[model samples]
Target: MKRKTIIVLVAAVAVALTLVAFYANSGIQSPKQEEKFRIAKVVRRDLGASVQATGIVKAMVGAEVKVGARTPGKVVNLPINVGDRVEQGQVIATIEQDDLIARVRLQEAILAEVKAEHSRLAKDFERDKQLHETKSISVQRYDLTEALHEIARARVLKAQAELDVAKAQLSYATVVAPIKGTVASVNTVQGETVTTGLTAPTFIKIIDLDRLEVLAYVDENDVGNVKVGQEASFTVAAHPSTDFKGRITSIYPSATIQDNVVYYLTSVSVDNREGKLMPDMTANVSIFLDRRKGVLTVPNQTVQREGSKKYVYVLHNETSEKRYVSTGWKDSSYTEILDGLKDGETVTIGDPGRK
Candidate 1:
């Protein structure tokens, strides 16, 4: 009886262990039976092909202005600094015009006194002339009075001309902006002596940020295709990864060679109304001149090659539908489908192994 009981116990244990193993194995999923992955089929309606080149962003109208005194003087005030916006004819700085104004006042006073003296002398000379002619006054007296009158008249004219000069000098004390732009640099500050009589010493640089352009260099091979008015797009290092649209407004007739490669200079118009872009920014330009439009497309990862045959698995009825496909134009993120794909069909981009 004991031996029979042991045999029964062993049999029951073995049966229970087998049942647990069967349930665990049933829960496991097979590779071929895994759930299908979903992907998008974005239709490429119109896509442009471009030739890319590295270039720089430049302002269309940039200027370096020297807010200096036409007459040498101490700078009383410099209202603007680097990165300040200014308008045309705005007074940017001021010089001490006190000396010039004082000189003008002195000249004016001297001019008034000289005119009076000349008038009195003129009367005296006329009277002397009449007296000399009648033998009442000597010729020497009349000649001396005439000489004094002429000197007074000449002095009056000289003082008036000097007054005009002083007025002109006074006007030069105020430094004004010549263009409407943002102040790019400030070389000198308040109380600094900046002389402008000899040469244009730059005190500040102003650039019209609203009017911006990109200088692109196209390679010799692609230069032939690049033409004025061609559409272009680019991104600056200042605003990296953000795209900006522009057009090829100009193309140089000449070619430049560097490191044994020839390239043509091209200019593009950029709109920087937001003022986010600055001068001398390196731009990554894409001169797009050609495009292709609307057709079936698939994710680049969806299409796989097997022994020179491209195959894609699409999803339908919750199952993977395997099919051969052909591809066309592709970019960094998308691939164009030429054949073996239909609209609204969900394609698989990866193996459906995980939940």
Candidate 2:
């Protein structure tokens, strides 16, 4: 009976030790309290921070031309069409010059007739002046001839000036390109009479293709971050595959506030020499301000606050170790490890089995 009791006790002790070893190996301390930590791997990507904004592409040198005749006339001819390339002095359209020519001729004829009359009157007036002094002519007759001569001379001068102006108006009737650019559009066709009454008619629009600008409307909250000379990259929907890169050229000081929201117009410089980017193309812009390269970094999730100090867990030889670290500029993913860390260090983070 004694031997049997001792055997039973030893068997019971062995069973208890086996249960304890299994429990320790399974990593189940308690069932009530379970926790999990998200983990991330430190990566190397060009960190870019930007205030995103929707913008439109605009031509650097764009002009709408009001090239109709300064004086109203019928459209005689339009040599250029939409999309036609024109030189600076090349004629694009012609207006009816017949009326101007007729008026100029009439004025010139009138000037000639008045000048002939003035010459004869001047000779007679000079004789009249001499005769009046010599008592050969009456004072009233001499004064009257002298006044007629002066009035005829003034009329001749006025007619000559009118003739010159009429000829000049005829020259202005031929509309010409003021800039070297592609004609965006032609408003009126040949034989279409555009009324030049009061306001001048816009005949064509010319846009220079070498240079371009990106007009971005930045929200009031992000406007403070926008500054001149910030590097930026953008892509337009028209050419979605191509990236248009530029620098912030300007920030409008005045804010456009409406409906309790405010925004400012920001302009950036772009190159469109390839002519792929047209005016009014929508742009997706990203402004890059700061970056870090090849520096010691940790997953931002590992950063925990212990009282007032920042801490990160380090794994060394099957033991969990925590170290205090200093951090610097951080993005949404990684925090810059400024101090208290080095490259290639293993950090313990995340759940081993929880969830």
Candidate 3:
């Protein structure tokens, strides 16, 4: 045995130097394992800065009214239908009032036959003015009895103006409801015979669902930062998880193109007193402008712009640095830092040329 093969060739060269020193210490790394970066902190709170229109919900200028039939007739007592609700004077429909109560009783019998011929021509003009002052009346029979007492006082003022135009055409056969709404549409049915001509044919269309309003359109490059009272919010499509709050009362100075894009209608208001909002529906607005309470924020993907200048990195004790900030108001995940950043400073969240 040549000394047992030199002790097994020195244990096979000590197991190939312990497998090349454990693969060169696992291919070197350490420094907290090459830091893998991804941090945040520099915060403080509150931030707003919005403006994203696209609305509809309308109905707020006299809140949709309509109601028609100013005299024609026939629908006789149509009570009310389409969603009813009414109130402001109620009635809602009832035309053919027996030929408007026979023209208000034929103008109250021609105003009681012209007030009984004006009380018999005022008693024959006071007995010919006392027989024409005792001269035995003969000044052409006292000027024809003072022109027959001024033609019976002009036939009692034309029969009291034809009995006040037959009591205003019998109060236009009652149709009422000038507001306080919800009816929406009726157009006639009970006996259907509506006919008015110069416009009063609507018959019903109320609507005041708590006076809604949203309209929003915007986008004339953000309608110059939309302002009127500011602060707003919306979201409808039939209450899509409800958000509805409002303010920006108006802005439409005209400009609404479409397909070529132009917009600018604004408005906003809406409270809808919990009626769940309606009319046209479709909102999705925002508005909010500028608000930055507490300040010192960060996270908007850790800033980092470069052309118009804007930066951030600062991680310290572990390394990162860069910095350069001076933001203001961003929202949608923070930004508003204003100066080089400090609050709790830590920043550094991704692609700084990704390791």
Provide TM-scores for the models: 0.57, 0.63, 0.40
Pairs that clash in candidate 2: none
Q: Give lDDT tens digits, candidate 2, residues 217-304.
A: 8866557767899988899877889888899999988886645567788998897778787778899887656665665667667776
Ranking by TM-score: 2, 1, 3
Compared with the true structure, model 3 gives a TM-score of 0.40
Q: Of the pair 2 and 3, which is ahead by lDDT?
A: 3
- lDDT for each residue of candidate 3 in 255-293, tens digit (9 for 90 to 100): 988766778888889898878887987898888887758
Best by TM-score: 2
**Cα lDDT tens digits for candidate 1, 1-355:** 9999999999999998987787668885444433333555545555554667888878774443435457787889888877888999998888888888889899899999999999999999899988988999878898899999999999988988998998888887887888888888788778887776557576777777888889898866567768788888899877887899899999888987776677888999998877778878899888876666775677668877665467887777767777887766543445667788877778787644335
- Ten-residue segment with the worst summed lDDT in candidate 3? 28-37
For each candidate in the order shown, give its overall lDDT on alpha carbons. Answer: 0.78, 0.75, 0.80
Regions more than 4 Å wrong, model 2: 1-49, 60-62, 125-142, 199-201, 257-260, 288-355
Residue pairs in candidate 1 whose N, alpha carbon or C atoms collide under 3 angstroms: 45-294
Clash count list over all predictions? 1, 0, 1
lDDT at residue 342 of model 1 (Cα atoms): 77
lDDT of 1 at 231: 85
Local error of candidate 2 at residue 75 (angstroms) = 2.6
